[model samples]
Target: MSWRTARRICRPTARRRRKAQWRKAVDAVAGGIERASAC
Candidate 1:
């Protein structure tokens, strides 16, 4: 496949993976805040 075709196929998956990581990070921060407040 050409570079452009490969990049088109790969880009969304990378973006999705990054979004998932960001969500997980946000969830972890929220959980930490809750725990701190509960203490």
Candidate 2:
């Protein structure tokens, strides 16, 4: 396989993983906000 093609394949996988991490972080922060408001 060409180097460029291999990189293109990897790029989306890396982006998806990063997006998943950001989502988890956002959920945790939102939960914290809710907990604080309840206090």
Top-scoring candidate (TM-score): 1
Candidate 1 lDDT over 1-39, as tens digits, reads 699999999999999999999999999999999999999
Number of colliding residue pairs in model 1: 0
Q: Given candidate 2, what's the lDDT at residue 39?
A: 97
- Residue pairs with colliding backbones in model 2 are none
TM-score of each: 0.83, 0.82
- Candidate 1 residues lying further than 4 Å off, grouped into runs, are none
True-vs-predicted CA distance for residue 30, candidate 2, Å: 0.3
lDDT of candidate model 1 versus the reference? 0.99
